[model samples]
Target: MPKHLNNQSSSVSLTVAAMGVVYGDIGTSPLYALRECFHESHGLPVTPDNVLGILSMIVWSLVLVVTVKYLLFVMKADNEGEGGMLALLALSQQSRPVDLRKGLNVVVTLGLIGVAFLYSDGIITPAISVLSAVEGLTLTTDVFTPYILPLTVALVALLFMIQRRGSGTIGSIFGPIMLLWFVTMALLGLHSLIQTPEVLRAANPLYAIQFLIRHAGVGILVLGSVFLVLTGA
Candidate 1:
């Protein structure tokens, strides 16, 4: 192959691999997020207006939180090609004046708390993703329903075991799996959009603002569920 062609192929391959390892949890959030938004506990009625409102929130949340916040801003703040809470902590300490650095014990405490949150999220995200995926089997038939919990537990345990081999190994194993998942889901979403093209109206920011204003109490609770979409980000 020509060198240019080879380089393009390599770029595409790396993008696919990154999509899996970095984005698998976010991809899987759809399995449960919409359901959680209208779950009985939230007392949200499943009307057309409500559906549009909730979807609008989801659309803007992805836009603002992931696209605008992470991709645009946060990703630009990396230290020496590294990112994450600890790296940011180190960067802050280095940039502060000696006199100001002494007052940064509070910053260190906050950074540690953020690290704990990230660690907790990593453990929780996979479990929820696996459990939600297994629960989808109930839609087809009840046969798998009885075993969902056991299967979820087994799958999560397997994931934990696989992690011991290092992230590179995990990425190599799961990258193609998640790439296939994303492609399958994209196709399904395209088909659904074809059927209900009107749903695209939910892309309007006004719908989200209206949703929160009209249903402030429930909307506040729903915001918690909406954040699920940001899990792997």
Candidate 2:
């Protein structure tokens, strides 16, 4: 193969591998996000209108925050080809004049806090993801309920055990698995969508606005749940 062809293949492989590692948290969140919207803690009824409203909120949030804000705008603000809060802070500090050093201390402090939050997410995300996956056993059969915690613990242990092999090896394995996972999710979503074509209307922002208007008191709670969709974004 030509050198350019080899380079192109390498780039594609890396992109798929990156998707495997990066998409896992956000990919699995849908398992609980919609259901949590109607959880008893939220005090929201599971009416059709409420469901549509919640769906609308989720769709619009992904579009606005993930697609527009992060992909389009934030991705362009990378510092030395890196992104995230620390990179943004570095870029900001670099752009500012050295004479304006008074507030730089505050900026550095906030950047450290952001890094702390990132570390917390790294710890919390996998625990929640594993728990959510194992919890699905309960839906299949109550007989599995008692084993859920133990099973989740075992799976998490195995996950960490494999981490010693490093990210490239993990990503190579996870990449194809994630591709299959996404395909399955797409098919399942399509089946449900066929049954309730009306849900497609929830893609419109008007439904979300109306939902908030109709249930102003509980709208805050619903928004909290909807925010879950952006957990790993």
Candidate 3:
């Protein structure tokens, strides 16, 4: 494959440093997503079809949003090296008429607010992931509970310490690690599928639509919780 456009020396350094800081949360997420998905909020083994449907939605969302929409299309719309909602808004404002410009600015400001919230979430995600993982020790034994904070602090400190070296040292390993991670996840999902093949039925959009329409009351109450599933990226 050709090198990324942002592959210059300084750019590469910055990317690695940024990845070192950003990837930990996502890298650790599979530790919980499948587990929680299978363990439904109700005391029933979640229908396998629903699990697969959700996974399918997640897979396609990544393909559409990350690969096609952002990488191929929106990234090409970059102004200089910047690309974000604000950048697009700025570009659009240049050509929009006065009447439309006022409406667009209101929309742009709201988009910017959401972008800022997501950015803040990204910055804090690592600490939250590490903290939650380390806190798991408490599940095994409350006697060890006192050590959780210290352990979390130590792990976070080490994570930050590696940022100085940048991600280059570990960069080579990431692709294989990600491959293994996905393969392992697929295996577990397949096992779940074997246990519950009926889940394959939810692949139809009708199931999701029907479920949402039928359970509007519960869905309304849990909309925020449902959205957390999409929060990792």
Candidate 4:
């Protein structure tokens, strides 16, 4: 009976729990995604259009993927809301025999693949998060240089040390903080939009075509980076 789903099915509870498990994956990324977008991928003298184009794409993708695709479409695709391939396998079996149309085998295989990738992603995400956060310590002192390993160790140690307590208390009281995060992100994007709305001409699929035609390699990289953002929770 987690707060999100009161009196829901055990299957629904399982699905919501899976969603909660991945919150860390999304939280870990906000630290670097945008910086990587404009600085590393788009490159500087980042024109307003470039920023707007990217921002528009990011926003709409969030709407499409998070709002429409996952929360709505994929969730509807859930097997009793437990989700993933394993759940789908169960539904397929209930509907027909395993050998009937190979549905059981196909769904089960895909389900296992999803779980495998997610397991790897779960481990890699936390490591990358701690690594990136600890790197911030380097900015304050050269003395911390020789101790990067130790600093990382200490930071990671502290993060794990708090795990048993859960962050529910902090999350409950810090609703405003979360709001500020979204507000600030929106404001920065609005600022960019105000500067060069025309860059939004890139919103046209033609721009994508031209971008691909002109700078195929960089375009592919930017697209790949954008794909990562779309994959965010």
Best by lDDT: 1
Total clashes for model 2: 0
Please report how far candidate 2 places residue 71 from its true position, in Å.
2.1
Put down candidate 2 lDDT per residue, 1-233, tens digits, no spaces.
Answer: 99999999999899878877888678888877888788897788788888889999999999999999998999899998999998888787786533444555767778889889889878877787788888988886899988999998999999999878898988887888888898999999999999989999999899999999998998988898888878889
lDDT of each: 0.88, 0.86, 0.59, 0.60
lDDT of candidate 4 over 1-233, digit per residue (tens):
68546656655544444444444456446565555665553563465545555555555656677888788777887776598656766776687556746444666667678878777765656566566666677778776677777776786677566555665533433334445555676898699779967756655655545544555567566655555554346
Ranking by lDDT: 1, 2, 4, 3
Quote the RMSD, in angstroms, for model 1.
2.4
Give the alpha carbon lDDT tens digit for every residue of 152-233 in model 3: 8898788677656655655543434555666687898899889978766645556545544655655333333333344565
Give the 10-residue window scoring lowest on summed lDDT in candidate 1. Answer: 95-104
| lDDT preference between candidates 1 and 2, better one | 1
TM-score of each: 0.91, 0.88, 0.60, 0.62
> Which prediction has more favorable lDDT, 1 or 3?
1
Predicted structure 2, TM vs. truth: 0.88
